[model samples]
Structures are given as structure tokens and as C-alpha cells.
Target: MSDYCGGCRYDPKQRVGDHACPYTAGYWSFLARNETEFSGNHRMRQPMQGLHRLTDLDALVDQEKARGSIAP
Candidate 1:
């Protein structure tokens, strides 16, 4: 969370739920969609490591497909 987001209703730390931040959801979605390409890249390996830890990956994909809304 940033100082700028202090007044925002959505939580930057959340990945799913009604108040979930779109950026967070999109970021995880992007990583999941590109894990194979990022897996071998040392620069992305650290964040990419989280790809395997995710539970409802399919839901993240749905969120990505929704474009801006993080709902569901």
C-alpha cells in the first residue's frame, strides 16, 4: 500500500474479493499467464516463484479477462 492509496476503499494488498485492487490482481494474472517465459529469467524468478503458490489461478485468469474490474 502506498501513501497515495491511504484514502482508497480498495486494498492494494488483497488479490481477490469485492474491494480487491485491480493492479494487484492484474499483476498476479500477468505472472501466471507468463510463468513459463519468466521461469527461466533470473530477473523475474523471485516474483515468478509465487506462481506455484497460488490456489485459485483460474479465478485470476478470469479477473485478467475482465480488464479493469477486480470483482470475482
Candidate 2:
């Protein structure tokens, strides 16, 4: 781990749950929120497919929405 992540509570590899990194959650949230807009783009094909594979996607979306503008 990098020195910057030594004391951080968030996990960069996690996208859900209490210890999820806000940035990671935010990324998936953005993709979920704009799936239609990005669906036709070739570059987005892989990520969009990956989004569909996330079993906890709905939960992640709800969590991020509940978090709103609050900082984690």
C-alpha cells in the first residue's frame, strides 16, 4: 500500500459496505446513473458489462444516494 493509504479507512478495491472507498463507489454510481448515455460508446462496452455483473449494484447505488453530498 502507498504511504498515503496507510491511515485511510477506505479500501480502494471495495465498492460497497462500510469500508468502501468513496471514489470507487462514486465511479460505479456515475456509470449506473449514466448507463444509457454511455451504452452506445465502444470504449464503455467493457465497463458497462462489468456493471451488469455487480450483484450488489442496487445496494451500492442506494448507499451512495443516501450518502448524498456528505463527505465520507
Output the number of the lDDT-best candidate. Answer: 2
TM-score of each: 0.76, 0.84
Best by TM-score: 2
Candidate 1 CA-lDDT value: 0.77
Per-residue accuracy of model 2 over 1-72 as CA lDDT, tens digit each: 556666889997888889998988999988998999999999999999999999989989989988893234
lDDT for residue 38 in candidate 2, whole number 0-100: 100
After the best TM-score superposition of candidate 2, give how far the Cα of residue 28 lies from its true spot, in angstroms: 0.5
Model 1 C-alpha lDDT per residue in residues 8-49, reported as the tens digit of each score: 898998777778787788888878777888878899977876
In model 2, the worst 10-residue window by lDDT is 63-72
Q: List the residue pairs that clash in candidate 2.
A: none
